[model samples]
Target: MSLLDDDAFPDMDSVSRDRVAPYIIRTEKRKAIDANGKPLFRPRRTQMAQVAWETRHHLQQLLYEAVTDYVREGYTTRPCARRNATSVF
Candidate 1:
C-alpha cells in the first residue's frame, strides 16, 4: 500500500502527516519530555507556520540540487542552463 493510504502507517503519531508530492514523511519536533515520559511539543503559536515555510524552502533546495547535478552530469547542452542552475543558491 502507498503512504497516501490512511492505513499505510497506522502507527504514526497524530503529529505527522504524509506529503503528496515528493512523498515526504514529516514529523513534529519535541521540545521536551515531562516526568511521565511523554513528548512535549513546542507551543504552536507560530511554530507550525514557520515549520511549513522551512519545509517548503528545503524542498526547493533539494530540487535545485537535483537540477544542478543533472546539468553537471552533462545531460543538458545549453550553457545558459548551467549558469542558471548554479546561480540558484
Candidate 2:
C-alpha cells in the first residue's frame, strides 16, 4: 500500500499530522486568503531527496567558507590543515 494511504495504517494519522503541522497551522491561521475566505494555497508534497541534497550542498558551502576563513586568519599555520581545508571544496 502507498504511504499516503492513511486507511492502511490508522497510526499514520498522528505521524503525518506532526510531519505536516506547519502547513496545517498556516492554513488554519488564515494568513493568506482570497476574497471568499478560502485559503490562498495548499502545501506541496515534500521532495525528501531534493531537500536532503540542497541542505547538504548549503552546509558544505558554509563549512568550506568557515575553514577558508580560519586558514586565512592564521588560526592554524600547519601545512596539513591548510591542505585539508582546500580539499573541502
Candidate 3:
C-alpha cells in the first residue's frame, strides 16, 4: 500500500513536501512557536526553504568538524591508501 493513498499524507497537519528537495526534512526554524507567549502557525509554503537553509548550515558545521578532527589526528597515521579497505599496508 502506498502512503499517498492514506489520509495521513494528504491531510497532514504538518508536512514537508518533496518539491523542497535538498530541504525536505525540516530542521530549521520555520515557525516561531512561542512569540510573546503565543502559538505560531507555520507556513507550509516556506517550510521547505527554511529547512534547506538549515541543512546547508548543518553540512558546513559537519565539514568543519571533520577537517578539524583530521588535522588534529592525521599525523598519527602514515599517508597511504588502505588495502582491502582495512589495512593501510
Best by lDDT: 2
The lDDT for every candidate, in the order shown, is: 0.55, 0.57, 0.48
Off by over 4 Å in 3: 1-56, 79-89
Candidate 2 off by > 4 Å: 1-56, 76-89
TM-score of each: 0.23, 0.23, 0.24
19-86 in candidate 2: lDDT tens per residue? 44443434454367889978787855765563334665988878878889987876657766655445
Candidate 1 lDDT at 61 equals: 78
The 10-residue segment of model 1 with minimum total lDDT is 12-21
Number of clashing residue pairs in every model? Answer: 0, 0, 0
Best by TM-score: 3
Q: Please give the RMSD of candidate 3 to the true structure.
A: 18.0
The deviation in Å at residue 31 for candidate 2 is 70
Question: TM-score of predicted model 2?
Answer: 0.23
Candidate 2 clashing pairs, residues 3+ apart or interchain: none
lDDT of 1: 0.55
